[model samples]
Target: MRNILILLTAASIAACNQSSSTMNEYKWPADVKPPIAGKEPKEFIAHGDKRIDEYYWLNQREDQKVLDYLKAENTYLDTMMSGTSNLREKLYTEMKSRIKEKDESVPYKDNGYWYYSRYEEGKQYPIFCRKKETLDAPEEIMLDQNKMAEGFKYYSIGGTAVSDNNELLAFTVDSVSRRLYGLQIKNLVTGVIYPETITNVEDNDIAWAADNKTIFYVKKDITTLLGYQVWRHELGTDPAKDVLVFEEKDNRYYIGVYRTKSKKYVGIYSNMNQVSSEFRLLEANHPAGEFTIFEPRKENFQYSIEHFNNKFYVLTDWEAPNFRLMETPEASTAKENWKEVLPHRKDVYISGMVVFKNHLVLSEMKDALNQLRVINQTDHKDYYIPFSETVFAAFQNVNPDYNTNILRFSYTSMTTPRSIYDFNMDTQQRELKKQQEVLGGFKQEDYTAERLWATARDGAKVPLSLVYKKGLKKDGSNPLLLYAYGSYGYSVAPGFNSNIISLLDRGFVYAIAHVRGGQEMGRQWYDQGHLFNKKNTFYDFIDCGEYLIKEQYTSTAHLYANGGSAGGLLMGGIVNFRPDLWHGVVADVPFVDVLTTMSDPSIPLTTGEYKEWGNPADSAEYFYMRSYSPYDNVEKKAYPNMLITTGLHDSQVQYFEPAKWVARLRELNTSNNKLLFKINMDVGHGGASGRFDYLKDKAWQYAFFLALEGKLE
Candidate 1:
């Protein structure tokens, strides 16, 4: 509320699509619609801010009337932030005290170090990383400061990926050039760090090849978001060993790569957001053909694949409305390229492939919950691993030593804390390596998890997960915080967060609205909510909110909504479409300007998102997207109190979108509840780099939700 001042730029948003849709040089309106997944955009137009602002502001008489009406309503800033913060502070303090009741000693390492990052309030260096844990927590120092003083600002360490041989460690660094980052490789044995080796490359995504001979990274020209290419670099090849790899002939397409069972393939998924994807595969060996383009099931369908259990497994809806996988023998790209390992079904999706020794683990998507399916690739027998209704999202890289026998995976959900566990591929014996426990002495028994359902306007069922204290009654009188992310075909996986403990301990229930635009309910579920059909997200969230109150999980007076980025669009649409449904809303780094944001060619994410958000100016699809553009739909009413925060460095959802949305909301709302904006100046789309800072913001956000639910005050 106090510090941030919008710097040099204060322009309206632009709209466009991915795949050279951005590079094609198109004129944009001063305003645009929200981003939705659909066909490539084909038109051009400009919007006047005055047109929409007049309904909320510009016209003093009408604006003042709306403002006066909202002035007397119970809003978030006055009720939720004030009340919830108090309850959370009390609950968090109580939980921390209980945990501290014992001076538990965690194993410390020698020459071993646990490193973390830091950002000072007003120093010349805005960001730095500190070494801790292995040694007693010491004075935090800048990460790789390396004696450079003036103008050597804006550097932070991205997460690291170690080579299989442990010889090289490739990481990314953000120098803030147009707010893009570069991938640099370092010899772990030699202590030789390659800073700026892949200089000025856009995006922080980088991966190391299995042979360790090459490191692959993504590069996008600063001038054009659509001009993106994936490149590979071999050490000692040149000053940076930078060698051009596969540069897409079509600037509209983008590629994603992942490793599967003894083999690695760069998945050439999609160029734009048009819902179509297929990939060309590259093997380390094979002179006759180093890479083979896999036959696509359909031109209209897009997909992603994972290699596990000696089989080529992928998620696609080619065979049916829902996405299943066609997997073949892992090493035998020799004969047939891909075979239907799992035939498609119209009802569900199969994801998260984890190959343990000779066995495979998969997460099956059936409407709401993710079911675990483990099978022996050779014997073709079901392991029937039951998880007591817990959603097993996906399995990450397993530890090497147990690759042949035991399988390790990390799983989380709304109610459970994120936990890392290892299981035997044969006996299914499980050991818990880590459970993000309450910091001091908090107990898991204090919380309970449940599945709830709400039917959408189209008679579609939305499954939701709720986590809260064990003894809470069914009367729904408890304060509620509902969350959702209904875009990108990405299913919101159930995982645990320690912060949820703070809320559960305070009698607050956290609910996840498993809505459309996500693969949670399978491919058809996603299709039902994308691009022109995007309004399904709002209707889904509203249904979830109304269901909560109807079930007595929470009163309408105590209901709150929260989402960030794509999900932020969800929060925006909900309050705008159904204002009386919520007490408070937190839309973090939201893309509210939708159609206009997509139209902007200069914005980092527009071109790439066109497939997701229809190009409003050029296509009939734009009319569908126009129906849900929130910025253009705000009504003169007592809207819920809101908090919109973003990072100045965020490229995905530009800071201007939230800033302008707030500016408009201030004029439109009749309520006097404070609308707060917190900007993390030195970070990107996700906000801060450090885990502690993220938790701080998380607490602040939930505190805001509590204030809205009437608990904090």
Candidate 2:
């Protein structure tokens, strides 16, 4: 069941550090510490008699994405040949036993009504909470997943959102496509989807104009990499109601979208040779055609066009590596007309910006700790929102009906599940939502979030987040699972995950290492950890393991590391770079071979993120990527127990990467054995079926964790 860890000339726990008692300074070979333990460390985990490519077919999905490879081979591997039966069958067989059925008696999260979607037979279908009795009832309409799998009509929505006058109900039904979709409309009290014309027109995102008459959404032309066109659709009896916006020739550049706050349109369009942005005022009364362009910066990169305070605000790296923002009057023109408000002073990318009634809100990060700041539109001054040092937080939406100056957001860290709060602008009083209560019959007071530092190879301190039961001392006595993802600009925020409750209730401690690659700290934090900085992510992860030991949060023998997708890379890197520090490892759909993976540009995020991870064609970048790639780094030596998982249909991080990495590892490492692998026959990158299917995945990982290290009786 496990891909026993290969023996390696692995770097000892001491080689990773300089302390005299540290494991060892040099990398040790696998044969040096053969995996002789009955923990089954020496067995190869591959499915014997099964060709690697055979699993490819069972798991292979003929998504349009794989067309390029199939065409190159002059083969038509379309649905006509493979179909989706195998996938559905695999999911039904693998996931049915893993999760509890959607029994109406079993309650779900309090966010909505917990019941089964009888419409769908096997899926843990979305439950419809249609009381509509109170205003506070489930208002955020539509679960994106439900819409994706079950279609628009059958899915359910939470929370109700009535227009300013309650004349129209602006509800969104979330559906899945290549991306999650929102089926939106102003209900005329008909229990059916309206505007038959709009219904036939396929569009994932649907945001209503303030007047509720016009709709704003992007029309994606998937011919090229970035061929999304922003369109404005007027909801009336007229058949030809929708119109092309920005009407530009370059499909990649003519990306227009409606901004919620200012109720205006923003997008980066090209003018002659220079690429810039255009802002348009879009309300029910004010139609398209009357548009305005603002702030013509010389340089061209990714910039955000937003409407705030009845004006336009542009956040772009036109002048710096990071984002700097500026605002213009009602119709400020050109680059010179712009006045800088928030300068791009540091390294982190801008996560989000919000405008409250009285205060213009800004959430920045030294790394990724939502550093809240408020700019009084009245006084034109910036004031830091008062809050303690916390990582991964945000300013929630505002209640439009109430004129009260207030804001809301949820914040948390390694140990904290989530503490949602409503902050009043005038009174500065905070109201807690749900009060950080622990579910699945557990106690919150039992766990704590520890903000510790793990210095990387260059002495830069990487942050580590730890959550353990209150009674557990820093004696390194309990099993520890350190999780992290250090790729792209994806910030691993400090919020609560209810599913994690499963692991927490078991007396096992959970720690999230906010290493360098994450925006947890800020811009500089990510820069130091991306591309050529990639090794920093791995080293930072290793340092986190070492820090946990030094802090006595856990011992080397009880420590484990895990990550998925990009984070899966984190799992592989930590194991390869410093295998001795971890007692076990799990890599899910890992991109362990960076150079090889990156060379293949057809991957979903690969093209755009080439800017983040260097182009391997460049010798320097290739050398750097290879230095940390887990697949290339795998050496014959003593290593820890491990689990590797992948979905045959995974289009993002291909299943082949993880499969190959594990195979190579099993063949190479002769360590203490205990290596494992699981490839879901039906799934894709997520490799999950339904709700229960996903949970079963979690349970399997957790079961392995408890068996290997929880020291269960």
Candidate 3:
């Protein structure tokens, strides 16, 4: 689930002059001890069951004791792993070497400007710039994020919208990493920023009202951080005077505003429990007009709209579980009036679509692989854009223009660096605009990428994407890292990752388990792994690990598991289900307190996630979740070495969840194995804001695995 607060890779460590040794051989300070949290038991009685939480007191973020405990844990980790400082630095340098220090994104044309972002040679942030009319024109600096980020410890720029006249730029920024962005406007022509600012706006939810002065943005609830209200604000006016255009009374729905590619209408989208959605549309020309409901909300009904020509195209799951494309006249925008444009197929899932003057491109998924189907509007003829790699990811890119025959998309695989291309629908030709330049001496042929299938315990075939240096032998001796995020119907793509190259080059096999709970194999795949069948996700991941061991790709002595957020939940569950199967595990910002989180609607994502993980207020659902909850299932048994990470200000899964889970695991674990926790006091769910800074966290993780593998030098 993309919406689930998942941790993106980021980290850093101080330089130390120390000799590195393997975990088993490294000397530890005799007096150094792990910080033990003083527990105060709190009991919750629900559904005729009582759960005693010993570390519930850690939830107090404002408490000095909680902060001290987190700091102590960090200090303890630094002391225990201090010997691997050199190894971490080496890994960080190696990984950073692969990235081009100064790079620019492919310029995309929108409105009358060719807009793109580029980083300076040594800058930590990008500078957004544009050229008027043509690429050859003089560059116009819209926003220099590098300059804006100078004074803040953490800064992020969210959605940026250029008015229809291309003179005013509306953007959102988050300085504290809580994802509560503040909306601001800049006059590109005058080089002056507007004084009026809107606070607590949703990230990437701002849309210009064709009038240029008026804009629509979603306001987030101060407590839950849920974007529930849509507001209309006019330039030069105080934001406090803004009108509340729409308010979603249902706590189950998350709302956002976006403009159509054709610039015809602005829409307010309401996503209901990730299972259904509703949209309100208004003409972009009428800023003060009320938005009419395109379609009322329905249970289990999902649809998305695209405007082109004179009709509205909808990608809907009304009668198709895998979804299909339909078209409805602009005057009649109801489900009954919708006519099928592309019929549904059991084998293929219509994931997304893009509208243009002469072509309609559909992003479809089949057998866990992505494909782009292009259709000719005149003749209704369709064909797929071919990809040579057996396991790769290809998806639509920035194509905001509606009258162009060219389509932009990105393609990448485990071995292939991400490449951008512009395909001409009329000529059946493609031009490679740019391919990521790996600064290090990296070659595609030096590594091997292959797709393997593992049969789950229930006989379902789960796919695994593997990548390693060439000449990897199936001897069950090589160290392997398996990753997955099997929730929210979000499919993990087999895309190229420059950071993983550091692991691959170090004789480590990197693989992604396309397990259940994700829509890798289509909608049914996700349905089977969520709610009552959620355990299927855990079972499938464990089955993949067992199959890998059985096939000699790796063994219990050398196999490791890694995941963040929901995937982190997978890491926790797998270790409990089969602790002896893994040598070490890294759970990043994991959501382990499942029953407690789902039972409390006050949590950020709790109310909206009832459909994903059943409402735990019910007896059956409560018991089911408790049965597998990592924090609840900790037992007095030998467990694998683990490193858990969390952020102080994470909005997704609160830091307290991991903090509490770790405290419980320490109480019950019977093994002498290390259980280290590293909490970043500065950043939120996603670690560092800078590109290179995030690699430090990656390096920290790699060093942990290398130390366990005795590969540290």
Per lDDT, the best of the predicted structures is 3
Q: What is the TM-score of each candidate against the true structure?
A: 0.76, 0.71, 0.97
Worst 10 residues of 1 by lDDT: 1-10
- What lDDT does the true structure give each of the candidates? 0.61, 0.55, 0.90
Encode model 1's per-residue lDDT on 1-713: one tens digit a residue: 11222211112221221111233321222232212111222233444222333222211213443223222121222232332434446554544443322221222121234333333422322333333444456634333433332353345555455565656667766655244565667776676776446665544456566677566666766655443666677765663546565566554455554343354554434444535666666664321234455654344675566555455666565655565666656566432466666777767576556655577677677756666677786797876555664544445434433246666666666555666676676887888766655566656677777777798888998989888888898786787889999998777766666666666766778888889888887877777788778888889999989988988999877788899899999988998888888878889889887866666666676766766777756656566666677776666777887778876667777665775576567656887655666656566577654333455566667666654444442
* Model 2 lDDT tens row, 1-713: 32233332334322332211133121212223322111222221221211122112211245433232222211111111112223334433443543334432211222122211222345555543332434445533322345445633223242233332324443443232222224355453443445533322223234555565665555544323232545666555453566766444532243434335443443334321112444444443455544445543333554555565556666765675557777766566455667788777765556567765577666676544666666767787666666654544554544331234666666565555556677776566777654444433455566676666787768887766666667776677877888899866566766666555555655668887888776666666777888777788888888778877887878988888889988988888777777788888877888876766666555544544465677766767767776777776788887788877876655567666775576567566877555666666455665554555575566556655655652322
Candidate 3, residues 296-410, lDDT tens digits: the string is 9899999999987778999999989999899999989988999997888888988999999999999999888998999999999999999899999999999998899999999
lDDT of 3: 0.90
TM-score of 1: 0.76
Candidate 1 lDDT (Cα, whole model)? Answer: 0.61
Using TM-score as the yardstick, the better of models 1 and 3 is 3
C-alpha lDDT (0 to 100) for residue 705 of candidate 3: 91
Off by over 4 Å in 1: 1-156, 163-165, 175-179, 202-213, 223-227, 237-241, 257-274, 285-291, 296-298, 303-315, 327-337, 389-403, 413-415, 474-476
